[model samples]
Target chain A: MNPIANRYTELVGIDHPIVQEGLGPFRTPKLAAAVSNAGGLGTVSMPGMPTDLDAGARTFREHIEECAALTDRPFAVNIPVGVDNNGVVLPFTDIYIRTVLDARRVDQSLAAQLTVLTTSAGFPGDYIGMIKDAGLIHQHKVGSTRHAVKAAEAGVDVIIAAGFEMGGHAPSKAVHSYVLLPNVTEAVDVPVLLTGGVRDARGLASALAMGADGVAMGTRFIASSANSDWHPTYIQAILDAKEGDDVAFDGVYGPCRGLKNAASLKLLNHQEDGTGEVIDAVELTRWKIESMQRAQTTGDVTDGLVLTGQVAAAIDDIIDIAHFVPNMAAGAAEILRGLASALPDTEHAFS
Target chain B: MNPIANRYTELVGIDHPIVQEGLGPFRTPKLAAAVSNAGGLGTVSMPGMPTDLDAGARTFREHIEECAALTDRPFAVNIPVGVDNNGVVLPFTDIYIRTVLDARRVDQSLAAQLTVLTTSAGFPGDYIGMIKDAGLIHQHKVGSTRHAVKAAEAGVDVIIAAGFEMGGHAPSKAVHSYVLLPNVTEAVDVPVLLTGGVRDARGLASALAMGADGVAMGTRFIASSANSDWHPTYIQAILDAKEGDDVAFDGVYGPCRGLKNAASLKLLNHQEDGTGEVIDAVELTRWKIESMQRAQTTGDVTDGLVLTGQVAAAIDDIIDIAHFVPNMAAGAAEILRGLASALPDTEHAFS
Candidate 1:
């Protein structure tokens, strides 16, 4: 028996409700397969926005195929919907969503393996219908209760409540998890996953207590042993981060959380809400993506932006995913049962 | 036996581990007594510092006596430790601590009723010795794991982990509850109570799951029906708040969370980390405190600063403390038990 399985696990066909959420602008094929092998839902991330849309789509397909080869368990792909200020969907978002749908059409085994499509950053507008028609569980991440309600009303299967403390590309509303999670859960009937400030079993149990069906973590998964695909220095930076060492900077999307290094300070110091300078907007976007990739590809902790969650301070060790995932769920189950049994029967005093 | 009794409730001699934490710079004697009478630890707030230190002390003593008279159950007094830039204890902090100690020394009944002392803002430093010597349970509020460890090492009986989302004067570190609470619980042996972003039974259960002994709330208590001492408009403003309405500005202490009104904008637009202009430091400090008091006394929520936590968005109705406190604890225990029992048995699947 999976000690913490619920509707979320049953819907996703995973043994545990835990998920290694998308850590985009970086690669996570190996990390995704490792978590899936451990009986938790894993996710393949969207690579950085390269100049060629077709090349970006090819890279995404390779990552999915690589993950399917490693584990037979079902997994997911995260595509952050990029919308322009004029509300028009960006070219990359259009290309990536279609890439996944077309790839699944060509191969039946790949279609079965990649059963979930997760969207973040912006509202997936009409893409929700396409994903649902493609026989994929649609999970849309939101930072506000209003958005959660709107998404649920629009037939989204799941909602991932993204808090301000979440890693790369946080909610523009800046709502913390403790205050936002319950509001999202209450607003939507579909399963809700809390995405921010979660590190271990205690966090998973706390998420359940706050009315979330499960937890979707990014930083914790980034610091695990299965993330050997990432540079050692990137993982070390996360382990070495202390409280207040992280800051939110203007990312390609909205505000992004990362270590307080030289590269992030450069972004925070300039840019006066798009009023300071009339430089190349496209160039600036590419630079941000390149800096993030540089950190992961080459171990440059100082100049490269190390996107991480606030929970990075609490994480010191690199965990082995296979053992850590199941142990975490089991531990959370034990804690909940233990606390219930330990309640002192002072009912008469309360009356 | 209480449904949620633990080291914290046992230490404070309260039926439940819930605490209506300090909402200082405002009178809360009636509100404090109502919570204490309802079986949770209630806290009498420190009155604003008038020009006369002696007068302020007299007012604070009266508030404590009023709370003691209203409730035979044990209660607490919240006195913020104010220290100057040079690290000298401010006159107001010194006077208020002495007033609580003197009141307890003279009247044995008052001493028995006011058993707990909570100190926030600055570190208690040498005053820890005085509080312990006076036979009061010393619970210091901290915003980081390092400070929690320091307070626990200095003989504090309990630690209230104040998150960045807390109302009034928040921690300088700005750590959120989910990220900081577990870190504090792991760093120290002292029973930790999570402060900030907590409202109902779900928050209480989440706190336990995160390893905290209990939860302390300021914004949740401020919106209660017992807080009639506050202007009805102030409570209504909190009720009307939606997400992203609250902002952290330059407060008397490091930072403060409150509604985004005209009063808070005045502070945020000016003052460049004490380097922009020659701000009459004392005058600015007095004006800030006066504005906070003005909102509480008068129903000027728009013009006067309305201090509140981000959790205000989640709270819509005023609750009766007599029914809310103990029932919240019971509800949390039920939720914990329900979640544990709902876990599906799939251990063989993981193996």
Candidate 2:
């Protein structure tokens, strides 16, 4: 008897609906494995794109294998489908999707553990059928109701509704979770997981109340004890963040939410007045990716790009995934029950 | 046995926790009265600032009187406290506050009906004492947890935690409800009402689940049939709104959310590059007010400022306040109970 068992948990064969979502351009195999072993779904994030597509794919494969080796329970892999101006999928996205499929095809045990493939940043148009054919649950992350509907209609197994307050790459339309969740949930019949501004039991309960099946968190999981792959300084910055410490700046994607540090401020200033030193579009994109990796690898939180959600301001303590995941589900259940019982029996008066 | 009875309903003396929040610069006496009659809190919005300070106060007084006359139930008045560059309370804010206090002093009946006063825009500083001394429930709307703590410490009876997606004047710090509500509720002992991006039962349930005592809606109520004070075209504009149709612009206060029409585009264009023809600061402020007023009075949805929340995308039909208010509360309670029952009894396993 799981405190929170729903379509999401059943579909992925996990004990709880809690998910450690994609924290790409950073190493997250250990964090992913910890969450999965704790009975929640963990996701192996894509590594930073390199000049050689095969090199990027190999790194992504290694992370997935590391997570699979650590956790016997089901987990996921997140590949952001980067597209060019012409809507053609980028080489990195193409290679990474293949890497996951290739790894699973070779090893039966690895295939059983890696049961979900989540795509974001752009539509997983052609790759949707390919992923579905691989017998993996295909979850596409979208920021708008229209996109949610489009992805659902296109046979995507799940929809992770991304809000403007989410860290790293955010939706271009800027709809916040309060509005976006209900809209997306109402528009599609697929299981909806809210991704943005979610931290604890209250967030999960709120997501469930708004018709979301689960919550996929990035910033919260990043601050957890299991996430030792990232630099401790990055976690400290998240813990020390106060209100208005984060800002949305131009990224490889349309808009990205991150700490308002020297790197992000420089990007913001350049976006506003076009005053920063001239860099080509390709060079700038590569530089942004490298900056994000630097923060995670070298603990350079000041000059390096620190991607985080607005909810980071409220997160103060590091959590242990083993206790936190199941406890979160139990807490949400208690809260929902308490709220229900608290409401007076006004059906006679109203009805 | 009210469907949604809580600290908010108990503190405010309303049957349901639902609230028809402020729709300022527009008339809403009839809409407010209808909500009050339906056992929810109704708020009489502040009229636009006029060249004649006394006349503006008079208009506000008349609106309050009209709402009181329509409903014997307790109602509220929303006045945004405007401050000058030196932080001195503006003449209009001073006049409006006195106008409500004076109205009650002169007429006991009006005092009995108008039991609440909600202040937004700036901190209620000196006016908090005045509002509490008047025996009115003082609910100060804030966007950050710091402000909520400050207002609660200052003795505000209630705190309406406003999110970034709210219509009209938004908070200077762009904290969305997903991140803002739980933070504000945790920071203060006073009852917190979630305002912004809320509509219908799911929104109410989500608000309550996130530790909010209730929900305060502006855009949802604006599209109601009771809101006849606003032009039908204005209502139609809200009905026609879709995802990505609303934008936040430089407002009279910090920022304002509204439909992306000619007037808003003009303001946004000017804000970006300062390319719009130079106008005196005072004159520009006056124009923005007049434009907002024009949309309400005349059917000028095209050129006038059509203030609305991001939730307008999901609001396609006009609701009747008589049924919508109480039904919304009941629906939320039912949903909460249903969700509580649906969860598996995994308490033993988790514990």
lDDT per residue as tens, model 1, A1-351: 588988999999998889998998899999999999999999999997878989999999999999999999999999999999899999999999999999999999999989999999899989999999999999999999999999999999999998899888998887999999999998999999999999999999999999999999999989898998899999999999999999988898888889899999888766433334554878888888899999998989899998999999988999999999999999989888777667765334335
Q: Candidate 2 i-RMS (Å)?
A: 0.8
TM per candidate, chain B: 0.96, 0.97
Global CA lDDT computed for model 2: 0.92
Chain A TM per candidate, in order of listing: 0.96, 0.98
State candidate 2's TM-score: 0.98
How do the residues B50-164 of candidate 2 rate in per-residue lDDT, one tens digit apiece? 8898888989999999999899999999999999999999988889999999999999989998999999988999899999999999999999999999999999999999999
| Residue A76, candidate 1: C-alpha displacement in angstroms | 0.5
Per-candidate total of colliding backbone pairs: 7, 1
Give the Å error, residue A127, model 2: 1.0
